[model samples]
Every structure is written in structure tokens, then in C-alpha cells.
Target: MIGRLNHVAIAVGDIAKASAVYRDTLGAEVSAPVAQTEHGVTTVFITLPNTKIELLEPLGADSPIAKFLERNADGGIHHVCYEVDDILAARDKLIADGARVLGGGEPKIGAHGKPVLFLHPKDFCGTLVELEQA
Candidate 1:
């Protein structure tokens, strides 16, 4: 099952600008952008008291984020991540309960260097959900 709200991710056309808004404008602690080649994104994390905000920029034309940007010209909330005790157990349970897991039901190393899986948006009230190993 899901635990705490890990982070809220926003797809952005310019990560630097997005990070700046959270950092300079909002006075939040923002991390330097790190490119995640496997996921085809450049990520920046904005630390907050309770949770975090993740800024995602497309790494290439074929990147999923790129596709999302095409659909949303100004970029927008991409997904919400929740912590889980065990990713495999969560995946299995969700599958059994008739939820679809994206990316072939396999966990991938996320920006936090933890196992993460994306759930289908349609299964979760039009919101793409991400489960991260806690």
C-alpha cells in the first residue's frame, strides 16, 4: 500500500526557469538539475517542509515528457509519487485489484535512486500515479 506523499512532479519546458520560480521566487531549497538518460528527462527537486516538488524537462524528442509537452503546451502536473513499503508487493496487489501498471510492470530506478513504478492515469482518476520504494 502507499505511504506518505513523496513528491508532486511537473513537466516543464524549461527546468531552470521552473526551478528558479521555486527557488528564487518562492524561497524554497532547489537542487541542481540532473539528467536522467534512461528516463529521458532532466530533473530538479525542490525541497519543502512536508514533501517535495519535482521539475521534469524533456531530454529528447522521443521522451515521454516531450509527448506530454506537445499535449500541454505550457507543461503541467505530470504525476504524483507516493512512498511504498515494498514495490513488488504493491505492484502485485494493484494488478490483482485490476489496476494497470505502466512500463511493463517493472520497476525502474527513479531520480531518488529508488525503485519506482508508474500507474495508469485512467485507473487513478485521471492522475498518473508513481509508487516509489520506501
Candidate 2:
């Protein structure tokens, strides 16, 4: 089952500008940009009181973020991540419940270096959901 809200991921056309808004304007604590080639995204994490905000920019022409940007000229919220005590168990339960997992239905290393899995947006009320091991 899901635990605490891990982070909210936002797809951004300009990660620097987006990071500046959170860092300069809102005075948030933003981390340096990190390129996640495996995930095909360059990310910046903005730490928050209750959770964190993840800014994602496409890393390549074939990046999924690029496709998302093509559909949405102005980038927006891409997904929401939740923590899970036992990801594999949660995954099995979700699967039995008819929820579809994204990718190859296997866990992958996330930005936090934690095991993570993405659920199909259609299965979660049109919002992509990420489950991270806690």
C-alpha cells in the first residue's frame, strides 16, 4: 500500500526557469540539476516542508518528456510519487486488483536512488502514479 507522499513531478519546458521560480521567487531549497539518462530526464529537486517537487526536462529528442511537451506546449504536473513499505507486495496486490504498471512492470532506480515503479495513468484517474520503496 502507499505511504507518505514522496514527491510531485512536474514536466517543464525550461527546468532552469522552473527551478528559479521555486528557488528565487518562492525561496525554496532547490538541489542542483541531475541528468537521469536512464529515465531520459534531467531533474531538479525542490525540497518542501511536507514533501518535494521534482522538475523534469526532456533529456533527448526521444525522451518521454519530449513527447509530453509536444502534446502540452506548456508543461504541467507529470506524476505524483508515494512511498511504499514493500514495493513488490504492493505491486502484486495492485496487479491482482487490475491496476496496470508502466514500463516492463518492474522496479527501476529513481532519482532518490530508491526502487520505484510507475503505474499507468489510466488506472489512477488520469494521473500517473509512482510508487517508491520506503
Candidate 3:
């Protein structure tokens, strides 16, 4: 089952600049940048009063974020991640209830260092959904 709403990811061209802007301009406290080499990106997390904001920048040319940014210059909301109690169960339930998964059928480690899986946008009312277990 789903728990709470986790961080909402925003794909950016530059993580440091975005983190600086959020910290200095908006007075948001940013967390230390972390590298997710498996996913091919570096991220800086800015914790908010409610939910967290993740500033994601591509680490290399073959990174997915690179294609995302290339597809849209303005950059858009990448995905919405939700905290789940059981990722496999949640995934099964969602699929049983008619949801399409984007990546692996099993959960994989995400940017937050938790098991995560993405439901396809087509199955999520045109918005990509990420289910993660804390």
C-alpha cells in the first residue's frame, strides 16, 4: 500500500545552479548532492516544509536526463514518487487494476536509495508515477 507522497523530481541541466537558486533565491535549505551513477545523474535534494524537491542533472552523455532535456528545452516535471509500504505488492495491485510499468517488473534502487518502480504515463492519466518503498 502507498504511504506518503515523497519528493517530486525536477530534471534540470545544472544541479548546482538550480540548488543555489533554490537555496539563495527562495531560501530553501538544500541537502548535499549525491551521485546516482546507476541512473546516470547527480542530484541535490532541497527539503521543504512538506515534500522534498530533487534537482536532477545528467552525469554523462548516455544519461536519461540528457534525452529528457533534449526533448524539451523548458524542462518539465519528470515524475512523481510516492512512498509505498510494499513495492512488489503495490506494483502487482496497480497492474492488476490496469497500470502499465515503464521499467523493470521488479523494484530497483532509485535516487533516494530505496526500491523504486515507474508506472507508465499512459497508465497514470498522462503523468508518470514512481512507487518507492522507504
Q: What TM-score would candidate 1 get against the native? A: 0.95
TM-score of each: 0.95, 0.94, 0.92
Model 1 error, position 121 (Å): 0.5
Better of 2 and 3 by TM-score: 2
Residue-level lDDT for 103 in candidate 3: 68
The lDDT of each candidate is 0.93, 0.91, 0.84
Encode model 1's per-residue lDDT on 1-134: one tens digit a residue: 68999999999999988888989899999999999888899999888999999999999667888878989988899999999999999999999999999989999988788999999999999999999998
User: What's model 2's TM-score?
Assistant: 0.94
The local lDDT score (0 to 100) that residue 75 gets in candidate 2 is 92
Candidate 1's displacement at residue 69, Å, is: 0.6
Q: Write the per-residue lDDT of candidate 3 for residues 61-91, one digit (tens) a residue.
A: 6888798898866666788888988888888
Order the candidate numbers by TM-score, best to worst. Answer: 1, 2, 3
The residue ranges of model 1 lying beyond 4 angstroms of the native Cα positions read none
What is candidate 2's CA lDDT for residue 109? Answer: 88
